[model samples]
Target: MKLIFEKSVPGRCCALLPACDVPVRPLESRFARKDPPRLPELSEVDLSRHYTALAGRVHGVNDGFYPLGSCTMKYNPALHEELAALPGFAGVHPLQPQHTVQGCLEVLARAEALLCEVTGMEQMTFQPAAGAHGELTGLLLIKAYHRDRGDAARTKIIVPDSAHGTNPASASMAGFEVVNIPSAPDGCVDLEALRAAVGPDTAGLMLTNPNTLGLFDRNILQITRIVHEAGGLNYYDGANLNAVMGVARPGDMGFDVVHLNLHKTFSTPHGGGGPGSGAVGAGALLAPFLPAPRAAAAGGGYAFETPPKSIGTVKAFYGNFLVVVRALAYILTLGGDGLSEASENAVLNANYLKALLAPYAPPACAGVCMHEFVVTLERLKKETGVTALDVAKAMLDCGIHPPTMYFPLIVHEALMFEPTETESKETLDWAAAQITGILRRAAEDPQSLHAAPCTTPVGRPDEVAAARAPKLRYRFDTL
Candidate 1:
C-alpha cells in the first residue's frame, strides 16, 4: 500500500472553500510555524479510495472473532453507540454550567448508581480516564485515607506475581513501594506469602480478582481479610470483571477501593490506544477522599458536588464522558439479569475454547478458568521451534486476530484467550479449528510457520525494530 503522501499530487485539492466572507486574519501571526504544513493533496475520490483501502486492511471486532484476553475485545452493542452519539449527550461541554447540563448529570449519576450497585461500592468517581488511571486514583484515595488518620508508615503496596503489569506501575507512580508475592501452585495468591508480605509499612494490596492468568482466587475473601488485618487497604483491579459482573462484587469481598474498566467490561468500543473510562468506586472508608465534582441527586435533578475531603480533580473534568454514556446505555440495555447471563456466557465460551486448545497449547493452570484462559506454547517451541509469536502470526493467515502473547510474565510462551459472550458457538468452533490447524502446521512444517501471515499486506514485520525504533511519522526520505 502506498503512503497517502506518496499518492499526493502537487496541485490537487480534495475540497473547494467558499471565498472569504469576512476579513481574513493571518494564521501565521496567531501561531508561529517555520514552514507550511506538508499534507497530502488529492481529489475527493482519490482520498476516499485511499481511506477505504486502509479500512479494508484494518481488523476489528466488527471484522470477525477477536479473542484478545484480559483486554476483552468483545463485540460492543451498536445501540450503545447510537445512544451515546445523541446530540444532548455528545455535545454537552464539560465546562458547561451544571444547571444547564441536567441530562448529562443525570447520566453520570445514574451510571454511578448502577456501577455502585453492581460492585457494592458506596461511592464512585468517573474522573480517571483509563484502567491504569483508575488504579492511580484509587491508590491516591488510599493514601489520603491513611494519611488523614496519621498513618504515615504505610508506604508499601503488595501485588501478586500474576497481576497485571499496570498494578505495580500504578503503585510505583503513586509513590508506594511494590512488594510482589508469588502465586501458589494452583495459580491463586499464596496465602502464607501474602500474610507474610503485609506489615506496618503496607499501605494496600492491589489485586485483580480473576488474575491475569484467568484463575479466580478461591481465597479472595481471606486474601482481602489478611490485608485488612495488617492495616492495609485492598484495591480491586477490575480488568477481569467480565467474568463476575453481577455474579460477584469486589466491595463484598472486603476491598476498600475498586477501579472498573468501563471500556473492557461495558459495551464501549476500546483498544488501539483509545478512549477508556476507569471509574473508581470506593467503600465508605475512602469515599471522603474521592475526586471532586462528583455527581449527586439534588432535588429532582442531578448536580455535581465535591466531597468534603476530595483529592481535588484527578481529571480536568468528568472522565471520558461519552465512554461513561455508552457504558450506562449498555447497563440499562442488559439490566441486572442480562448482565449476569453475559458473564456466564463469557466464562462458558472461554472454557470451551480452552478445551479445544488444550491438545496443542496446554493451559497455564489446571481447572476452570473464568472469562479468559492462558495457554503455554513452551512445549511446541521445544519440539518444533514454533514459538507463540509464530502461532500468533499464523493466525493472520486464518483471517483471525491472535490472542494476547507472552503476557502475565509468570507463564512461559503464554497465549491468553478470551472468547467473550458475543461470539457464537459456531464461531468458537471455527476459531478452535484454526488454532488446531496452526499447531499442526507448527509441528509438521516449522519453516512455513516462520514465514507466516502471507495473506496480510505486510508479511512478518520487524516487530522488535517496530517497537524499539518506531517510524511513527511518514518521511519523504523513507519512501
Candidate 2:
C-alpha cells in the first residue's frame, strides 16, 4: 500500500466542484500563502479505494473481539447512530434562540435526568469532550467548591497507583498537587497508605471502582468513607463504570464527582481520537460547581441553566452534542433493567473467558473478575524470552486484535483483556483458543514468537525510533 501522496499524479482530477456562479472572492493579501498547498491529486475512484484499503487495515469492535481492558470496546448498536443523525438534533445551532430548539434541549435534559439517576448523582454536565477532559472538569469543580467555602488549603488530590495514567495528569492539569497511594497485594487500595496520604491539604481522591486489574475493590465504600472523614471529596474516575453500571454506582459509594466515558460504556463509537462525551456527574455537594450551559426545564419548556458557582463552560457550546445523542439513545434503549443485565453479562463474559484461558495464561488476580481480567507473562518471558508483547503480536497474526499490553504498571509483562458483554460465548471460546495457541507457539518456537505477527502487512519496526521521531505528515521534499 502506497501513501496517498505517493499515488498523486500531476494535474489528476476528481471533478469535486462546479465552476463558480457567484462573484469570485479573493483572500485578503495578509492571509494569502506564498505557495499553493500540495495535496493528494487523485481521481474519485482512487480516493475511494485508498480509504477503503485503509479501513480494512484497521481493527475495530466490528472487525473482531476487542478486549482492551479498562477501555470498554463493546459493540455499539447502529440504532444509536441513526438517532444521532436525526436532523432535529444534528442540525441544531448553538447560537439559535433557546426557545427555538426545545427538542434539542429536551434531549439533553432527559439524558441528564436519566444519567443522574443511573449514577446516583444530583446533577450532570455534558460539557467535557473526553474522559480525561471530564476528569479535569470534575477536579476543577472540587477545587471551586472548596475555594467557594474558603477551604483553599484543600490542594492535593490523592490517586491510587492502580489508577489510569490520566488521573494524575488531569489532577495536575487542574492545578492540584497529586499524592500517590500504593495498591495493596490484592490489587485494591492500600487503606493505610491512603490514610497516611490524606491530611489538611487533602482536596480529594480519584479512583475507579473496579480498578485496572479488573477486580472490583471490596473496600470501595470504606475507601470513599476514609476520604470523606478526612475532609476530602471523592472523585470517581468512572473508567471502569462499565463493570458496575446499574449493578452499582459511584454516588452510592460516596463519591462527590464522577466522569462517565459515554463513548466507552454507553454504546457509542469509540477509539481513533473520538468525539466523546465525558459527561461529568456530581452529588448535591458539588452540583452547584458543575460546568455551565447545563440543560434545564423552565416551566413546560427546556432551557440552559448555569449552576450558581459553576466552574464555567468547559467546552464551547456543550461538548460533542451528537455523541451525547448517541449515548442518550443507548441509555434509553437499554433502560435501567437492561443496563443491569448488560453489566452483569459483562462480568460473566470476562470471568468465563478468564476461566477458559487460566490454565494456559494465568490471571494476575485470583477468583472471579468484574468486567475484565489481567494475565501476566512474567514466568513465560523468563522461560522462553517471549514477553507479553510477543504474544500480543502473535495474536495479530491470527487475525485477532490483542488485549492491552504492559499496563497498570504493577503486573510484570501484563496483558489485560476485557471480554465485553457484547461478545458471544462462541466468540470468547474462539478468542481463548487463539490466545492459548499463541502461548503454546511462544514456548515451542520462541524465536518465531520474538519475530511474531508474520502475517500482518507491516511487522516489527523500530518502535522507539517511530515514537521519538515521528514523521507525522508528508514532506514536500520527499514528494
The best candidate in terms of TM-score: 2
lDDT of 2 by residue, 198-278 (tens): 888999999888888998888889999999999999999888888898888889988899999999999889858697889
- With a 3 Å backbone cut-off (N, CA, C), the pairs that clash in candidate 1 are none
Give the per-residue lDDT digits (tens) of candidate 1, residues 366-460: 99999999999999999999999999999999988999999878889999999999999999999999999999988889999999989998887
Task: Give the number of the best model, judged by lDDT.
Answer: 1
> Superposing all C-alpha atoms, what RMSD in Å does each candidate have to the true structure?
1.8, 1.4
Alpha carbon lDDT of residue 467, candidate 1? 94
Cα TM-score per model:
0.96, 0.97
At residue 35, what lDDT does model 1 achieve?
A: 80
**After superposing candidate 2, which stretches have Cα over 4 Å from the reference?**
none
lDDT of 2: 0.90
